[model samples]
Target: MSARLPENPAPLTQALDACRHRDPEGFHRLRQAVAPAMLATALHFVQDVRQSEDVVHDTLLLAWLNAGRFAADDLPPGSWLFTILGSRLHSQLEALAGRPPSAPRAVPTGLQGQALWTLAHGLEPRPPSASLGDRLTESLLARLAAPQLPRTPTGELVHPPLYDARLRRKMLTSRLAYQAKEGFKRRLGRPLEEWAFRRWLAQRSVGQWLEAQGLPRRSVEAALGDRLDLEVNPGRLVRCMSYPDAFPDRTERRKASNLFLWSGDWDLPHHSLADSSRTRFIQDLWTHRLEPSRSETFRRLEQQREQGRPLRSHHKGMLLDSRERILEYLRLYLLYMENMACFGFDKHEGKDRLGVTIDRHGRIIKTNKGLHRLAMAQVLGLSEITVRVRSVHRQWWQRHAGDAKGRDALERVAQALPECVPA
Candidate 1:
């Protein structure tokens, strides 16, 4: 009799065929294949390493349970797994305490300091015949010629008052005087004073001016809408008026001042209700000694098994906390870049601010974004105008290329841009 053929095929082949036939992989090959990207996606969404890992674990379980529904053609094994990971991650993110999806910050990649140092310094060196002194001198001169650093006034640096008392008093006094000069007695049938009416008029005037300046009407309305609402306080306007020296144009300073006073910290109520003091305190703590503290924490955790101590709750908590901080840092960095692209400067004018000059036409004339975009385009041998045109014609590309390639192409274009643009 012929030897009986082995009944089962190789696991990988069996698994692939099973996947094609929509059979669950009892061997967990799918989990192994997709775990790294899933983990990265989870980490990005949750901004906490432990939580992200937990999310990955849950994602694997879900993928296993729903494996039969996965179509080999529609999602490919990798993307199907990532879809589940992303869904779970979004759910977890929505449930996080004291954090909004719109939070301005981002998390860091948590790259090791030594690794980064080595990678940065490992670039190709100049030829031996090149003048090292000339290069060094040029570098020094470039650094010296960089834009002036912003100086925070002594009183403005730490715990600055929301609005300077003197400024507030002056603004109130001016409004009262203006009302008297206008002879605007209480024309309203209600018992409101002339000064209140004048304040409303001032707000209306500013709103109209903003509309005329081509500011998005919705944004202007949203920023100033409740000016007439008695319950809403316009303290931010006072703060803006107090910081005239911070603004470049006198008219913009005045408009911003009025807008701030009228708006009175539009974000305050949302933050207060959410009770984000803990989050802010944690952020400040992380920002203070991020590198050293992160290194020590990583080292301690790495040696935990050999130290005869199992991972304690506190250690786990610290790791999660640090991961969140790092994630937040990266998110913030991305946002800073996005804001610089849109607004010509960093919103907060922090140390990371790129002080590039922009032209009146919203063209980035001399800013880092312009330079980077130009340098990237040149490196890729793409015209600067072509890059901009491609961005504008993205919808057409998407229509023709379908979703995946279109997205991939767009991302590639973005990555290649900085190389073409001048830095």
Candidate 2:
């Protein structure tokens, strides 16, 4: 409503405070937090790109006007803006539907995802999928046998607008170099308690840049969040996020953000942990319960055999050349995972704990990382296993992370961890 500069890089809630007094700079900062996603999802529903921009502009105005009524604790500020944006898009679409037919706008429609092998720059609309089974099935099977998801093998994959993996790798190495110079002993054992704390200091900013660009930074955040060592119950993880292979072809997973609500029912079996082949493979490996075909990994590998992707960490020098060798490697991997579940997760693996996210309602949503271990944890009915926070819902952040930053934020999040995670 008005204008003033924040004296510091205040948290979103504090920025909202600046807005209460009509600081245009605060409104601009607020726009930076939520507008990218508001625009992204608006494009998904509003067919005309120009019209979508109009919808976003109107929705932000509504958000701005209502900023005083916004409650960071009751709901994430981003989610609040999204609720308004969704309504605006609905009304816009309705108005268009009521209008008489007219010439199509020459401006380009937007693209949500892209292909890996081609120059084509858009997502192929998903063909109609088979409708899901009972809601009970989604709930029961989610914690059961869902596949490692973000099913990039076949999802609408996307990346940060211009980032590639080689570039990302260089970025990480650069950060670690700075940390090393800061006197953090990368080689030494840190008390488990300090893991997340240290991460808060060094990398809380890991995916903040992506929020302005309107992407789900969860992938990178999970990989790089406050790397807390949390021993959570296997049952606590009742759901997970699902998307098709949409991680940047260059980066390992999706772009990161804690702002928008991506999807809640991603925990459903149809979404993850229930791929027929993966389910069959789990049955074959863990229980001999299914007379399944060969592991899907092998079949997938058969096609990619020409690609010659090396089996990472295989003891033998390898290529996708030998089935017998691959089988042995799979068996060893199974055993290694088993030992971690049965004997207690590695005491010496340092911060390589299972990565997880917390939803606004506090559900443990498993990420694309650590699918094998997650499955094992569920199947074995292990009571507890260590994990780290990758990213959390903005509502989760407001309640737990609050307005705190640095060690204060770390301490707040750490105290809230086991308590906020569902029992």
Highest lDDT, which number? 2
Model 1's number of clashes is 39
Please, what is the whole-model Cα lDDT of each candidate in the order they appear?
0.33, 0.46
- Which residue runs does candidate 2 get wrong by more than 4 Å? 1-227, 243-254, 257-270, 274-280, 289-317, 347-351, 401-410
- Candidate 1 per-residue lDDT over residues 1-423, each given as its tens digit: 111211232432444455445444432454434454455555544667666665555555445434555556654444444455544454355436424332222222222222222322333221211232243233223323322221122111211111222343444454456566445433442223223333333554443343223233223233333321111011111111122333446865445422211222211221120123322332332232223234433345336534655242221121212433333333333222222222222122442221121111211222122233222222222211211111112222233324333224334423432332211
True-vs-predicted CA distance for residue 124, candidate 2, Å: 68
Cα error, candidate 2, residue 32 (Å)? 68
Candidate with maximal TM-score: 2
| Per-model TM against the reference | 0.21, 0.38
Task: Give the Å error, residue 72, model 2.
Answer: 54
**Candidate 2 per-residue C-alpha lDDT over 159-241 given as tens digits, one digit per residue, 9 for 90 to 100:** 22112233334444544565674444334423322454344455455333332232233333443355445667765565555
| Candidate 1 residue 381 C-alpha distance from true site, Å | 48
Clashes of each: 39, 20
Runs off by more than 4 Å, candidate 1? 1-27, 97-423
Range of the 10 consecutive residues with the lowest summed lDDT in candidate 1: 232-241
What local lDDT does model 2 show for residue 176? Answer: 56
